[model samples]
Target: MKKILVCGMSQNLGGVECFLMNYYRNINRNKVQFDFLCNSESCAFEEEIKHLGGKVYHVCARSKNIYQFYKDVNEFFSNHAKDYDGIWVNKCMLNNIEFIKYAKRYNIPKRIIHAHNSNNMENTIKGKLQGLLHYIHRRSIHKYATDFWACSRDAGSWAFPKEIMKGENFRIIHNAIDSEKFRYNVDTRELYRKRLGLTNSFVVGHVGRFQYQKNHEFLIDIFKSIYHKNSNAVLLLIGVGELEDKIKEKVHSLSLDNAVKFLGVRNDVAQLMQAMDVFVFPSLFEGLGIALIEAQVAGLPSFTSTNVVPQEAKITNLLHYINLNESAIAWADTIVDSQAIHRELYVQASMDYNIKSAASKLELHFSNICNK
Candidate 1:
């Protein structure tokens, strides 16, 4: 079996991690095995990776100690370079190229740089400086890496220049999911609603980490408006992060404590999705919204911010993209006016963003690379 080193694994249960897990679960592990190299010492998926016959290695974080990070990476590649045939690095920002530079030095045949985000959420001076450095490093990406990949066209265009994106080495890999698991079911909706004591309420759902990029503050504002208009309306939030407490405080200040529920980092996302009447995602920006795709698979009408999410995410007519400048009351009005139409949308999701098809295409790509 040919081994590949995969980078960017973390303890956080966010979009990038979810996309990686979906791909890992569907890929043909017998022929091509993946070993993760993460900056943190521990991650949530480590145990499951071990169970699946993969290994996880820890290195120093780049932000904490750049010199130590490089030392650890160099030592690792020096000792175990021969064990892997390739390196696939998934990065949220395109600012760091040291990983790919080291991989090239180790003579890895297939060095792949996969971009997962279109823009960084940070807007500080330090962030601007880092962006400048990213621009400098991106100029030399083709010199160190053999392959380029992204989750969407916007992501690819942001990571690489237009010329490189138009080159033959670039590939757009969709953020696919298991549509069968997310299919809408009335029985599941009833069961989850009863379990959560939401039998008589109209639930507005949002699934994402509590971060600035997700615009949870705006979502809360919109939910507050909805609650004032309809006392029976409930807002269900799933996932956790550093900003959870701050958001909770905001909810308390707005006196929306009883109307909002936060269920952090859930394993039963599909079931929870079934219980929702509408999915609201008012993100500041996104490379590709995976949760929105999952919501469509669950047959829920979704409202997202325009220019943030790509149009390719709309596999069904259930998705609606609105401008961020719109008032919270406008968002609330749209949410209330929209009616949930129950249907098995998994068939369309399967055709547009299926894990099986993605895995097969990836396997073929790897095979072709090996043949050459």
Candidate 2:
């Protein structure tokens, strides 16, 4: 068996975490046993991973300067590097330079950095500076990494500009979801909506952390516009983050307490997806919108921003690309139209973006890498 070490920083149940967990569960574990290394003692996916028959090693990485953490991580890698054939780094986002460097120092044959977002690379001077540093570090460590996988083409391009264009050791592998778990069933939808007292309402749901990237302020604006036109329309914001209070305050200020509901950190996301009439994901940016694809698998119509990758926009007519400056009224108008649509075309679109298919692509890549 090829022993693989899956290392990650955060324990929060976000898009990147979800993707890693799915990969752990669905990979050909008999041929490749995975050992997870994480910073958190109680990650949201911990129990699920154990249930999947994988081993977990808690690193509990912490440091006052973050530079010290690298020294500690390097020591850990030195002691443990021989046990694993390859290392899969998840969310190698902002603060994983040291880990990458240490992997290189230890001479790991296969090091993969899987990026999950486009992440505002050109947003500010500081962002640009960091991007330059990241680009430099990535290139310096290029010899150590046998391959690079990105959740979307945009994400891949943004994170590995030179590597991708040069056709050197890069692939765009999107995040996956279990279609069996998020299957389309009308009865489940009706039952969930009725249980939630939303049987009479046209439900517009979005499942994601209340982070700046999600642009909750703009989400509230759009929800307010829709509520103003139709009081019976309900907005479901499922998932919690720093912006939760801000969003709640905005809803209260708009006197929309009844129309908008905050369901934080739900365990039944798949069932909830079925209960919705439409899914609104107007995220400013995403590596790949897993929730949007989940909505697709649930046979629910979705609307997203132009910033989201077109590949993820499974239902072309349902999706609208609007500038950030676009009014909430414009988003509302589009949502209203999306809710009115009755199309089978979207169901076909959903199948085309199945998570199993995405996993198959990854499996092929793994086979190719081992062969080479």
Q: What does candidate 1 score on TM?
A: 0.96
lDDT of 2: 0.73
Candidate 1 regions exceeding 4 Å error are: 340-347
Per-residue lDDT tens digits for candidate 2, residues 301-357, read 777787565565554454456666679998898788776577332243343355666
Off by over 4 Å in 2: 62-68, 92-94, 121-143, 315-318, 343-352
Error of 2 at 312 (Å): 4.1
lDDT of 1 by residue, 190-268 (tens): 9999999899998999999887789999999999998888899999999998789999999999998988999998989
Write down the TM-score of every candidate.
0.96, 0.89
User: How many residue pairs clash (N, CA or C atoms closer than 3 angstroms) in each of the candidate models, in the order given?
Assistant: 0, 0
lDDT of 2 at 342: 76
